[model samples]
Target: MKRLPLEGIRVADLTMVWAGPFATKILAEMGAEVIKVESPQAWDLVRTLIPMPGVEEFWNCSYYFNDYNRDKKSVTLHLADPRGRELFLRLVERSDVVIENYRADVLDKLGLGYEVLRERKRDIILVSMAGFGKTGPEREYVGYGPIIEQMAGLASLTGYGDDGVPYKTGISYGDPVAGAAAAGAVALALIRRQRTGEGAFIDLAQREVMATLIGEAFVRASLRGEVPPHRGNRDERYAPQGVYRCFGEDRWVAISVRSDEEWRRLAQAIGRPDLASLTLPERKARHDELDRAIEAWTEQIRPQVAAQVLQAVGVPAAPVIDTEAIHDDPNLVAREFWVTLPHPRMKPWRQPRSPWRLAEANPTPRRHAPLFGEHNTEILGGLLGLSQEEIAELEAAGIVGRAPVDARPGG
Candidate 1:
């Protein structure tokens, strides 16, 4: 097997929920030893976010959680406890990085601020991903993914053309977007530490990262004094760009005609000779009519055929692959973008492999996520050199555990 990029690194993952987990998941896939530290009193909300009716231990069985949390170890620690904090500081001393998506003040409140951890280990990289960052007027406001979307100004941008009200994407878009940025920040911070041998603090704001995606809109606002109106999937620069319905349950194909040549070819392919010479402005003005015409041809045709036909005619087109369809996508399957791993608590299902195809380093999934506090003894007893008796006392004091006390089988 080709060695992964981050084989020698160890990260103390203090993030719960999506953004933090998503980043750590990527790092784990890249061969980092990520220790996911969560509190016993308040576990990762995602572990119990949704309950499956007849299944026992749904938290451990959640495909949603397992899919994103593979290749990592879990260690339950009540950091608010003095003993737990001290033990965690020891782990920090041995770790290359500490990452948390806690609210800005959470660590400071727990008396485990950056300075405290850095005191224990001089060169420790810390990545804090608060929604509005550590310092800002809006920093105090509590938020989750939906709230972040609204506060970031992205929700204002998405809407059906007929409605003035904003709409969020079907998924929590902000979380994963923030996650990718946070992961990249980790790589940059690690490289910087290589040169300087000094620890750095990274404060990433979810809202700020989300706003960066709308740079063109900001440019328009600054120069032209205009906000973008919803174009209903139509590109402002293109005459005809829309998703057309294909034959099947909600199957669709997104198509874009970039150039006059492409439009000509598309027109020929659709057998519309009379409209072939229509100018860009003319086509754009009648985009709705064109969409209906395009759908008329596509509504009975399968998505694969629709996409292939458009692409063959030089028009860019792709079928919208949803979660279920994505696994069976021939291109993705051929590329080996999905992997299956068996788990004691869950049935085998397809999990997405890392999209980072570093040709030389070729990172692959190593194992399923660790059971709760699965490595407590390995980390505290072996690595930290704590005696077995001390480990037992900590467990007795409720400082460390294999699982949360309140972990009644979710649903």
Candidate 2:
């Protein structure tokens, strides 16, 4: 097999929750060695975010935690402890990168700031994913993905016109966006370091990354001094574009008629032959009537069938696959987009493969997320050259553990 791009790269992952872990996940998929460090006193909260009923070691069994954390190793180290801090710095001296998504003041409070890491390893790449960045006026403010979206002005643009209430996406939209950006930043920093022989500190604000996605909104506001009106699923440019209900309960298909020809095709596909010649302005004026006509035809068929009929007639259409049904999506199945990996704690289930498919390198997930601190002995003894007695001492002192000291029923 060909070598992956990050085959020799090593990443010290100190990120918890979604944003930082998502970024390191990409690196791991591309063949980087990602060592996820969590404190025994306060391990990643996601481990117990949703505790499984009647399950021992529920932390290791969390599907939410395992899904985002596959292809990585776990090490327990309480940074607040002086011995643990020293051990982490020792690890840093041999690592190529250290990434974290703490609040702006947290790293410095623990005395493991960029400057400290730089002293340990001169060429260590530090990627700090603070929610608002380190230098801004709101740097000290704490936030998560939902708050990031509202603060970034994304939520302001996502509401139905009638209700006048902004709606956040069903998922945490800002996290994965920032994660992808952070991964790219890591690649760019690696390139620059190769040329300059210097490390980099990437101060990525999640809100800033989220805000960049709405550039067109900014441009329109700056030029015309107008806030874009909430249009729900309707697009001003594409008349008669909306999600319509299909036959099954809560099943829907989204249809967009971009060009006049496409609109004509869509009209005929829904058995409205007389409306095929309607102009753009006419369609815009009668969008409600067209939607009713479209839904009448759509409600008679399954979402997939409705989508297939419209798409076959040259109209842009797609069925909205829900969480459960998405697992059986034909296109994804054909592309082998999901892999089922064995886990020590959980049963094998289909998990998403890396979306970044390099035809030559063929990067694949190597293992499930490590059992809590599963690699402690391997890393401390093999990689860091610690003696068995020394590791045992650390464990006896509650400095390292296989389970969280603060573990409870739910996180």
Candidate 3:
């Protein structure tokens, strides 16, 4: 088999929920061995967030969990316990990278901070993703994706102009954005390590990274003490840009008329040739009117068909694809965005493969998520040189186990 870019990398992933797991998923897709350590005492909350009615191993069956956790091994360990700490450190000593998304204080409190991990293995790269940074004033504030959006000023920038209130995205958009950057951070740290033979401690703030996307807004803030005005989907640079509703149930098309030529092309395409020669400034001044005009034409057509019509005439347009529709999108399918893998406990569903498609070294998912501690004997005994009796002793001592005792989905 042709080796992938990250084929030799091993990561001890202690992240739960979206941000951390999303990053590890990318690494796994790029051909890294990811050991996901969880605990019976307080497992990943997402495992039980939406449990199926009577499924026994609901944790292993979650679409959300499995989506991000594919191609990794799950190992249950209580890090608060001394034995768990010792075992985790043992794993860390052998791991090339360690990732966590716990609160700023959690890792150090667990006695597994970057300094301590570096002591165990001098060149161990550590990526810590807190909502804020470890040393910021906002570090202690509890933040999920929505909170991150608000804190990062993204929410303030998203809303219909008529409404004074800001609107949050329908989904937790911050998680995946931060996750993608974290994956890149891990790769950069590895590259730096290759040059210097030293490890890096990456302090990634979720809100800060989310804020970086709007750097021009920061310049506006500093130069003129300006806060961005909410223009809904409209951009300051592009006039007559918005998402318009189409014929079907909640279907919409996003259109951006960048130049006078695009506006004329779109106008002609939509049979509004009388309004074809409107300049950018004129379009900007009458954006809402233009939106209504566009929607009038679009409401009679399917979003996909409308987008294609606009695109055929050189307008930048696309359908606002929803979850189910996106899975069936021909472009994404042509790009091979989705994949299905068999799992022993669950039937196959569409899961997104990594977007980082390396042409020469194409990485593919090798296995479903490992059954809880499925490689205990192989990893602890074979890799760590523990004798069979010693392994038995460790299991007997509550140092390791396949499943969590008294484990409910989240419990």
User: On residues 1-411, what C-alpha lDDT tens digit does candidate 2 reach at each position?
Assistant: 589999899999999999999999999999999999999997889999885667899889888889889999999998999999999999999889999999999999999999999999999999999999998799998879999999999998999888789999999999999999999999999999999999999999999999999999999999999898899999989988999999989999999999999988887888888899999999999989999999999999999999888888889999998999999998999998889999878889999999888879887788999889999998888899999999999999988888988687677
Model 1: how far residue 70 lies from native, Å: 1.0
**Model 2 misses residue 263 by how many Å?**
2.3
Question: Model 1: what TM-score?
Answer: 0.95
lDDT of 1: 0.85
Q: Write the per-residue lDDT of candidate 3 for residues 155-260, one digit (tens) a residue.
A: 8788876867899989888899999999999999999999999999999999998999878888899999988888878899998998999998999999998888
Candidate 3 clashing pairs, residues 3+ apart or interchain: none
lDDT scores of the candidates, listed in order: 0.85, 0.92, 0.85
Best by lDDT: 2
Tens-digit per-residue lDDT, 1-411, candidate 1: 678888899999999889889999988988889999977777787776664557766667666777778899988788998888888998999999999998889989998888998999898999999988999887766557887888777877788668778888788888999999999999898999999998889999988888898788788889999888877688889978988898999999998988899988888877676778878999998988888878888898998898898888778999988879888988888999888887877778788788888888877777887667778888888888989998898888888876666765542
Candidate 1 global Cα RMSD: 1.7
Which segments of model 1 are wrong by more than 4 Å? 408-411
Off by over 4 Å in 3: 387-398, 405-411
Please report, as a residue range, the 10-residue window in candidate 2 with the lowest summed lDDT: 50-59
Better of 1 and 2 by TM-score: 2
Give per-model CA RMSD. 1.7, 1.1, 2.1
Q: Estimate each model's TM-score.
A: 0.95, 0.98, 0.93
